[model samples]
Target: MSLIASSLTFMKTPLTAKLNTQLKLFKIKVKQNTMHTLNSILRMRRDIMKLLIIHPHLSIIGGSERLTQILVYELEKKRKNIEILVLTGSRNKELFPETSKIKFKLFKEAPVKAKNLRIKKLINAFLTLSEVMDDFCPDAVLTMIQEPIYLVLSKIVKPSIGTAI
Candidate 1:
C-alpha cells in the first residue's frame, strides 16, 4: 500500500487518535494559509490601478482627439496614484500640446496608398493592443470612441479588464 494509504489505516487505530486530530489541524492550517495567500494577492492587485486608453488614430486634431487629450489630462491631475497608458494606431503628438506628457504606445502607421488600408490598420491596432495589454496588464480600459475591436480584444486577451467606452 502507498504511504498515504498506510497512514490512513494507521490513523484509524484508537492509539493514533491524537495523530488523526493533528492531521485534521494540519489540514485546517493549510486551508487557512491558502486563504491568506489568496487574500494577499487580491489586496495587492487592488493597490495598483492601471488604466489603458485606446484611441485608434490621433494624427489629426478633432473633437474626439481633443476629448481624449482632455480626459488624459484630467485623469493625470486627479488620479495621482493610478498608472495610465494610451494606445494609438497613429499619433502626431505635435498636434496636441496639451497631451505632450501623456504616455502613448503608437502602432506603425499603415501605408496611405496601400490596398486594404482599413484592414491593415485594424490588424495593426489589434496586434499592438494585444501586446500592450499583455505587457501592462491594465486593470481597466477606456476608449474615447465606440470601437468594437477594443471591446473584443479586451475580452479575448484579458476578460478581467473592465472596458469603458
Candidate 2:
C-alpha cells in the first residue's frame, strides 16, 4: 500500500508540469492576438477618413439633393479611403439610386406631445442627431441650412469642421 501511494504521487508531478507549460503557451498566444488587433486598428486609423453629411429632409428630389449625391460620388471617386455617411429622415430611393456603397443612416423621428409644433420637432431631431454623432464620430459634418440648434451642438461636438452651406 505504501509503494502504490508513492507511485501515484510521482505520476502527478509530470502531469502538473505539462499543465503549467500549456498554460504559459496559451497566455503567449493571447498576448500575440491582442497585439495583432491593436496594430490593425492603428493602420485603419491612418488610412481611412470618416465624413458625415446631414440634411434636414430628403423627401423630395431637387437641386440640393442632386448636388449632394453628385458630391458624394465625386468624393469617393477621388478618394477611395473616404467613408461617406448621409443622415436624413426621408427615404427616397430614387434620389440615391446609384449610391449602393455610400452609407445611408435614416434619422429617427422623435415623438412629442405637440406634434403640430415645428420647433419642438426640430429640437427632438437635434437631440437624436447628437446621439448619432457620438456613435458615428465623424471627422467632419456638412449641412446645408444654418439651423441654430446645429450651430450650438456643433461647437459642443468639436468635429474637424461643421460646414453650413
The candidate that wins on lDDT is 1
- Report RMSD (Å) for each prediction in the order shown: 7.3, 6.0
Candidate 1 local lDDT, 70-112, one digit each (tens): 8887877786566778887678768644343357888755344
The Cα local distance difference test for each model comes to 0.77, 0.71
Instruction: Name the 10 consecutive residues with the lowest summed lDDT in model 1.
Output: 93-102
Determine the backbone clash count of candidate 1.
Answer: 0
Model 2 bad stretches (over 4 Å): 1-37, 97-101, 146-149, 157-164
Q: How accurate is candidate 1 locally (lDDT)?
A: 0.77
| TM-scores for the candidates | 0.61, 0.66
Candidate 2: count of backbone clashes, pairs at least 3 residues apart or interchain: 0
Residue 9's C-alpha lDDT in candidate 2?
Answer: 48
